[model samples]
Target chain A: MAHDRQPPPNPTSQSGLPLRAAYGIEDVPADHRASIGILPGEAPFHRGCFAQGYRTKPWRIFQLSGYGKPEDENERIKFLLKTGETGFLMEHDRSTADHLYNVDHPDVVARREDVGMTGAPMQSVRDTHLCLDGIPIETTYGHAGGAVVQHGPFALAAYWTVARRRGLDLASLPGTGQSDFFLTYLGCVTKQQVPTQAGLRLNADIIEFCGEHLPKWVPVSIAAYNGGDTGLNAYEELGALVANAIEYLDEIRRRGRMDITAAASRCGGVNFRTTMDIFEDAAKLRAARKMWHRLLTERYGVSDERALRLRIHVVTSGSKMTYQQPLNNIVRGTLMALTAVLGGAQSLGVSGYDEALSVPSEHAHQMSVRIQQILQHETNLAAVADPLGGSYYVESLTAELERRAWSFVDEVAAQGGFLATLDSGWLHARARANQIKEFADEQSGRRVVVGVTDFTDDVSPFVVDGFPGVNDAYDVALERLRAVRRERHEQGARKALVALEARCRGSANIMPAMMDALDQEVTLGEIGEVYRAVWGDWQTPELV
Target chain B: MTAGQRRILLVKTALDGHWRGLSVVAHALRDAGFHVIMGGMISGAEIVRAAVDEDVDLVGLNVGGHTLVVERVIGELRAARPQLPIFAGGVLPPSACRRLGELGVETYPPGSSLEAIVDAARRLTQVHAEPDAAPP
Candidate 1:
C-alpha cells in the first residue's frame, strides 16, 4: 500500500484518445498535413511500406513457437531457429487443434492431461511431418498452425503436405495461415466453430486457393491481433480490421475467382497489437498504413501500389503482461518492442515475459529474443523509416486514428458487414465494452498498471515456472493416433474421407479436399468428423 | 447471507476455449449477485454431472490444462460435492499455483481482480452479505 506516482489527471489514449500536452501543426488534421510530406514508399502509406525501413527489412523475428510432442514441437522449433528466430510459428493443439480432436477424442480422452498444454499434438501427415522435421521448408517463413477457423483447412493442408514432401513448390511456398475471423470469431471463442457463414466460405476458399496454388502463401491472415487481444479498441482494432477486409474483399468479389488485385495482395498480410500505448501504439502502425491506403483506394478500385501496402505484424500485447512484477515483463517487452519498431512493424511478436503467467519459459523465449536484438543491434532503431514521422504528437495521433478508424468502418458497415458484427454479438459487444473499460481503468487508480497497479513490491527472487509442455503429450498423441489408424491407405483413407465430405458439401475449395485429406492419412479426429458432420456447430453467440 | 441464491459452477478445465478469462469471471460473478454457471469445456464426468446437477454452491475451475487435468477435476468435484466449494482461473503457473494451492483450490493467476475476483466469490459462496445485500 504505497502508491503515489501521479500522472492521470486526464491523459487518455489507449483508445480513449484525449492526451495533449503539446501537439501542433494545428493539431495535425488539415488533410493529415498533406500526408506529412509523403515518401516511405508513397501513396498514402503513412510514411512506411519501406523507404529503407529497418534498413530494408529487419523486423521479422517472428516468434510464437509451439509446445509438446510433434517431437516436442520440433525441438521448440529448432530452439527458435537456433535462438535468433527470424520466422517460425506452428503452435497447434488447442486440445487437438481447437477441437478437431484426435489423441483419442472423447473430449481428448477426458482432458488427457490437457494434451500438449496448448500446442504440439499435430495429429497427422505423420504429425505434420514430426512438426516439419528438418525445418527447411524452402527457406523458412512458416506459421502454418491454423490459428483456428475450423483449423484452417487442416493447418494449411498440413503445411502444404510438408512442402509437397520436400520437393517444394506449391508455387514456391512461404508462410502465414491463421484462418482468422478474429481468432475464432472474436479472439479465442472456440468451443467448436465453422459458422461465420462457414467462416466466410472458408476465408473465401483460402483466398481462391491462394490465387491458384499458394502464390507464396499468406492466404488467410486477418488477425487484428485477435481483435486487439480480445477487447478491440485501437479504433476498434482499426475498425474491425477494415471490417475484416470488407469480408475478404466482398467474398473475393462475389467469387469472380481471383483478381481483386490479387485479392488485395492476399488481404495485405495483417496482424496488429503493440500495446503499451507508446504514442497510440506508434500511431497504430501509422494508422494501419493509412487504413490500407484508404481501404484499397476508396473501396476497391485498388490500382495496385502493391495492393495499397498494409503489411504489418505485431504481437506484443498478450493483454499487456503483468502478473505481479514478472520481471516487469521485461520492461513490458521492451516498451511493446519499441512500439513495434516505431510503428512500422513488418513482422514482430514480443508477448512473453512469461506472459501473465505461462507459455514461453526458455528464459521467457530468450527474453523475447533479447528484446528484438536490443532493438535490432542497439537502437538506431534500424535507422528510421517512420520514426514517428513528422510528429505533431505523431501527426495528431495519426490523423485521429484515421478519423476514428473510418468511424469504426462506418459502424462495421452498418452492422451487416464484418461477419454481421460477428453474427450479431455486435463485435462481442464491442469487445465487452473494451473489457469493462479496461477493468474500469485498473479499478480506478486511473490505469496505473506498472507492477500491477502501481509498484506492488515484488522483491524478485526470480521464479517463472511456466512452459511445462511435454508430459508425453497425451501418450504420444495416443500413439500417433494409433499409428495413423494402422498405417494409412485404408481405401485411400476412405476415399479421402469421401472427398472431404464432398468438399464440405460442395462449394468447391476445401483446399483440394484438404490436400486429399492430408494425403490419405486423414486423422485429426477424422477431419473433425467431417467438420462435425458438415458444419453443424457454431451456434456460439452468447459470449459472456 | 446464502439463504436463497448462491449457485456458481463455471467449468473449462481445458479443451481450451479461452472465454476471455471465463468471460471476466462470469461478469464478476453476475455482478456480485452470484448464480453464474457457464461450464463450457466439460468432462470430469461432465464436471461431476454439473456438480450434482447444478446444485452448485461454488465450483469455478477454468485452468486451461494440466495440474493433472486440474487434479482430475478436483478429484471429480471432491467426489461429487462433499460440501462443494472450489475456485480456479486460467493459465495457472507458479508451479500450477502451488499445486492448486495444495488442492483447496482458489488460484486466480493472470493478473486477477474483478475486485479480487468478486472478493473470491464472496468468500467462496458463503456470501457474507453486503454487495448491496446481494440479489440485484
Candidate 2:
C-alpha cells in the first residue's frame, strides 16, 4: 500500500494543514505579522519560553512509571531513576485510584484481574507510604497520581501525609498533583464520579491550599493530553486547554481567596500531546504558550510575566503508537518527542513501544528514557529553542492555531465556561466529531497510519503480548485492606471520618481534614463514601 | 419499510472508554441501513438481555479485557439468541482470534477494512441486494 501511493503528492502535508507549492510573507495575516518579531521569553510567547533554550536547560526526561503492588511500583520507579529518568510519576490503577474505590468495591470486584493492569493499587496511606519507599520526594519533581478528578484530594493528601510521616515539611514538598477534570470527565470517564461543580470546588480548594502551603507544588495540571488522546485534534486540544484554565481561574476569582495571578501561574503548568505530525503539533505547543499569555493578560487583566509564561509538559501521543508492528512505536516515540522539543516543552514523557498491548515493560520504559536522553545529548536539536520559530509555515501555523483556539475558547465561554460545556456534553460531542472524522480518514485511505492501515509486513523476531503486570496485586491489595482495618486505631479512624464528613458538609477547604483522615488511617473507600454522601454521583452524558 | 429492518447489537466487553473503533463500526452499519443498538460496557446478563429484547439480527462485541469475560458474554448471548449471527473486534490477538472463530463468530482485529466490515454486516444481517446468492 505504501508503494501503491507513490505519486499521490504526499496526500497530506508535513503540517497536516493543506499546502500549496510555495508562499510569500504577504500570505501571513496582518495580526500574525505583528508578533513575527517577538523572541522567546517575550510577551505572547509564541516563539518559546526561554531565550537560551536547551543551552540553558534541557527538557526533563520525565517518564510515567508505575505498576503492580506499591512496593513493586516503588521498585520500578527507583529502577527508572537509576536509568537516568530525571523525574518520576506515580501511576495509580484506574479501577481503584481513578474512582477513589478500594479493590473490594463491587465494580472493582467484578474485574479482579484488571485490578493492577494499569498501575499500582493504593487503598490507604500505608500503601502510599509503600509506593514512596526510598524515593526522595523533597528534591525530585514527583507526580503524585491524582490524574482523575474525584481521586485528587485523597491522592494528594496521601502523598503529603507520607511526606509528613517522614518528618518532611509540607511547605517544602516539591511534587505536583494532577487533578485533571479532562481525564476524569472527558477522556476516560469512569463508571462514577463527583458532580462537575463538586469537582471544580475540589480543584479550586487544591489550588488555594497549595498557594498557602507547599509553595513549590503545581497544584493541578490541566492535561490536554487526555483531551487530545480522546480525539480532540490539535486546534481543539489547544482551545479546550485554554477553556479549562479559564474554569479554574474563574472559580478561584469567585472564591475571592487567592490572587488571580497566582492561580494563573499555578494552573499555567499545563500538558499537551505531540504526534508524528511534527510541525503541526509543535506549532500547537508554540500556539499554546502564545494563547496562554494573551488569555491571562487580556481576560484576567494581569501583567505578571511569571503568570503569563506558559510552561508545558508534553507526553507523546500514546494512541499514535501503532499496535501492528510494536517495535515501530520506538521510532514513533522519538519523532513525537522531537516534535515536542521543536515546540519547546519544559518536560516530556515518551509513550512506550508496547503501549497498545499493555503498559510499558521495564525495557520499554528504559527505551522511553533513552529516547529523551539521545535527543538531549546527541541530536543537538535542543541547543536552540523553537528552531522552527521564524519559518513562515511554522509561524503562520502557530498564529492560525492561536486564532482558532481563542475562538474555541470564546465558544466555551459563550456556553458558560468549560465545566458547563462538560456538564452539558457539548465538549464530548466536539471530541466525538473529531474522533469520527479521523477514523473516517484512515478508513478511506485519505490518511495512512503506516503499520496498521498500510505497510502491513513485519520483520520483527520478538512477540510482544505486552506486560501482564504482577499477578499478586489483587491478593496483596486485599490483604493490606484487611490489615489496615484490623491493625489501625479504630477510634481515631472513626473520629477522622466524622471530621471528614463535617468538612465535606461545610464550606472549609477539605484538604486539612483530608490530611487528618489520612493520618488517622482512613482508607480510600471510606473517603469515597463521604464524597458520595456529600456530593452525590454525576449524571454521565451518553455519547450514543 | 420494504421488510422488517435489520437490528444489530453492539457492546463493549471492557470498561475502557476508547470508542473510536465502536463508533466507526456503528456509523458504518447505520449507513449501510441497520438498526445498531449500543450496549456500553454491560455485563453478560445485560448483553443477553439487549440481544433478546432488541431481537437483533447480528451481535458485534468490542473487547479490550480478558478473553474469559468475553467468552462468557458470548456463551450467554448464544444461549439466549441461538439464531443471531455474532462478530467481534478490538485488540484480539491471533490465539484469541482462533478461539472466537472456533465459537462460530467472525473476528476483525485492528486493521480490518471498513469495506470488509460493512460487507460482514450485510452478510450477517442477510441484507445483500441479491440475497439469493451466497456471500463472497
Candidate 3:
C-alpha cells in the first residue's frame, strides 16, 4: 500500500528553514544562547525534568485505558498494569460522566448504546468500587475521571469514597482529578454544565481540598491536549494552558486559602498532545517547562522550584490517527510517541492505532505500550533529554512559540481570563478559526496526509472495524443505579443531598460535602440536580 | 459573498460534543456563502424545529456517535419536511457511509474535501443543479 511519492521540492515547514544536510554548532542560535547551555535539571527545563533523565526513572508508560462496565474496566486496568503500565486512568462514560447525568437521565437513556462506549459507566461509589476492585488505590497513581468541568467533585468524591470504604486514608491517597475546563468548554462542550465561573469555583474548591487532604494529588490538570485536539496549534495550546493555570492561581489568590505555591504545585501536573508535527510539537513541550518556570517565578513571584517544575503527561494526537487503513496509524502513533519522548514528557499515552475508528482493542492498547517500550529500550534516545535543544530551527521555534503563546495568553487575559473566554465562547472561536485553516490547508494540498489525501490504497489483509466496547454497559449501569438506590440508607442519602445543596448555595468548599454525599449514596444525578438549582447552566458559544 | 446568503442548518444528531470536525466544516460552508445555523447537541425534535423555523434548504448532521441516532433524526426530518435534502459528516466509517448513502443522505467522513462538501451543498440546495441531470 505504500506509494513511493516523491518528496516536494520545497519541503520546508511552516517556518522557512531549508531541509538540512545535518549541520552542527553553526545551527545553534545566538539569542537562545542562555537556554541552550542549561542542563535538564537546571532552570528553564527545556531539556527534561531531571538531569539523569529516564535513568533516574523511566518515563511512565501511562495508557488511558477504560470503557464498558465497571468490572470490565477494572479488568482492563489490571491487564494494562500487568503489561507494565505505570498508571491507571478511570474513564467515565461520556454520556453520563460528561453531563454529570446518571444512567436513568432521559438524555442518557436516549443514547443508551453510546453509554460506556468511551469509558466505564460508573455512577456511584459502588460502581467506583467495582471499577477499582482488587486494585490498590493507596500506592498506585490513578486518574479519577472527572474529565468534564461539572463532574469533578462527584468523580473525585466517588473514587475517594471507595478508597475510604476500603480503609484507605484520604490524606494518603496518590492520584489525580481531571476537572479540566478545556475538555468541558473547548473540545467537547457538554449539553449542560455549570457556568464557567461556577466551574472555576468548583476547581478552586477541589484544589484547596486536595492541598489540605490528599497532598499527593493533582487536583485539576489544565489539559491543553483537549484544546490542541480541538484546533489550537502548538503555540496557542501553550498559551491557553498557561492562561488556564493563571485562572486557577488567581482564583486561589482571591480565596486566600492555601499558599499560592501549594496551589501551583497541585496545578503543575498538566497534559499536552503530541501530533504528527514532530519538530513543532516537541518544541511545544520544551517551551512549556520554560514557560511554567517563568510564569511561577516572574509573574506569580513564587520561588519554590517544586512549584515551578511542570510535570507533563502527553497523549499522542487522536486526530492524527486516521480512520482509513487504521493499521498504518501504528507508525503515526510511534512517531507521535517519539516526539513526546524527545520533548521529555514525564508520562505518555500513545493514542491507539484504531483511534479514529473506535476505542482501543486490547491488542491496540498493548501495541501502544509496545511502541513506547521500543522507543525506551531499542533506541538509546531516552539517554539524552531534549536532543534537539540547541538547533537553530528548534531553539528559534521554541522561543517563537513561547513569544506567540504569551501574546495569546494576553489575548485570553484581555478577554477577562481563560474562564471568561470560555463563558463568552471566545476561545471556541479561536479554535474554530484554526480548525478551518487546517481543513483548508489539507483541501489545498498544502498538508499531505498519506493514505488519506493521497496514496489511498491498502494492500494489507488486516482490517480493523474497531473494537465495540461491552454491550452490557447500559443494562449493568441501569441495574447498578437501581441497586444503589434500593440499598443505600434513604434518610442518610436525603440528608447528604440537603447538605450538598446548602454547600452549593453557601461559600463553603463542596468537596467535603461531596464526599459525604457519596458516602450517603446520593447518586450522581441527584448532585447534578442540586448543581442545576444553584449555579445554572453555562451558555455555550455557537462554534459550529 | 454577502452575509446570510445561502442558508445551512448544522445539527449534531448525537449528544457527543466532539466539535472539531463540525466547526471546521461549518466554517467552510459559511465561507462558501452559506448561513450556518448551529443546532448545538440537538435531538431529532430540535433538528426538525430548527429546519422548519430557519427554513434551511440543506441540513448538515455532525454525526459524532452512532449512525442509528442520525438515521432517526433523518427519518424525523423527512417526515416533517419531505422536500429537505440532508448530508452528514463526522467520524463515520465506510459501512456507516454506505448506510447513509442507502438512505440518499451523502456522507462526508474524516479526510473529506471542503470543495466536495461545498459542491454538495450547492447541488443539494438546488442553488446549482446537478450537471447532466434533467429537472426532477
DockQ ranking from best candidate downward? 3, 2, 1
Q: What is the TM-score of each candidate against the true structure?
A: 0.37, 0.94, 0.93
Docking class for model 1 is acceptable
lDDT of 3 by residue, B3-58 (tens): 54778899776667888887778778877888888888777877888888887788
- Tell me the spans in candidate 3 whose CA falls farther than 4 Å from its real position: A1-31, B1-6, B127-136
**Residue range A1-544, candidate 3, lDDT tens digits:** 3355566667754322344645455555555666788888888787777888888878888888788999989999999989878888988888888887898888877677777778888888888988999998888999998989899999999999898888888888998889998999999988898998899999999999999999998898889999999988888899999999998999899999889999998899999999887888888999899999999998788898777889999999999998878888999999999999888898999999888867789999999989989999999987776788777777766777888889989999899888888878888888887787777767767678888888896798886767777788989899989998899999999999999899989988999999999999888889889999999888888766
Please tell me which model should have the higher lDDT, number 1 or number 3.
Answer: 3
What is the C-alpha lDDT profile of model 2 across B14-105, one tens digit per residue? Answer: 66666767877888888788888988777777788887777678889988766666788787776666666889998676677788999988
Task: Give model 2's docking category.
Answer: acceptable
User: What is the lDDT for A244 in model 1?
Assistant: 87
lDDT: worst 10-residue window of model 2 chain A: A6-15
Residue-wise C-alpha lDDT for candidate 2, range A434-509, written one tens digit per residue: 7777877777777778888788888879887777678888889999999999999999999999998998898889
CA lDDT of each prediction against the hidden true structure: 0.82, 0.85, 0.85
- Candidate 2 residue runs with Cα over 4 Å from true position: A6-16, B1-3, B75-86, B93-105, B124-136
Model 1 lDDT tens row, B1-136: 3568788888887777667767877887887788887878888888878767767778888887788878887887776565677888878878888878887788888777689888887887784333211111
Give the CAPRI class of candidate 3: medium
Spell out the clash pairs found in candidate 1.
none
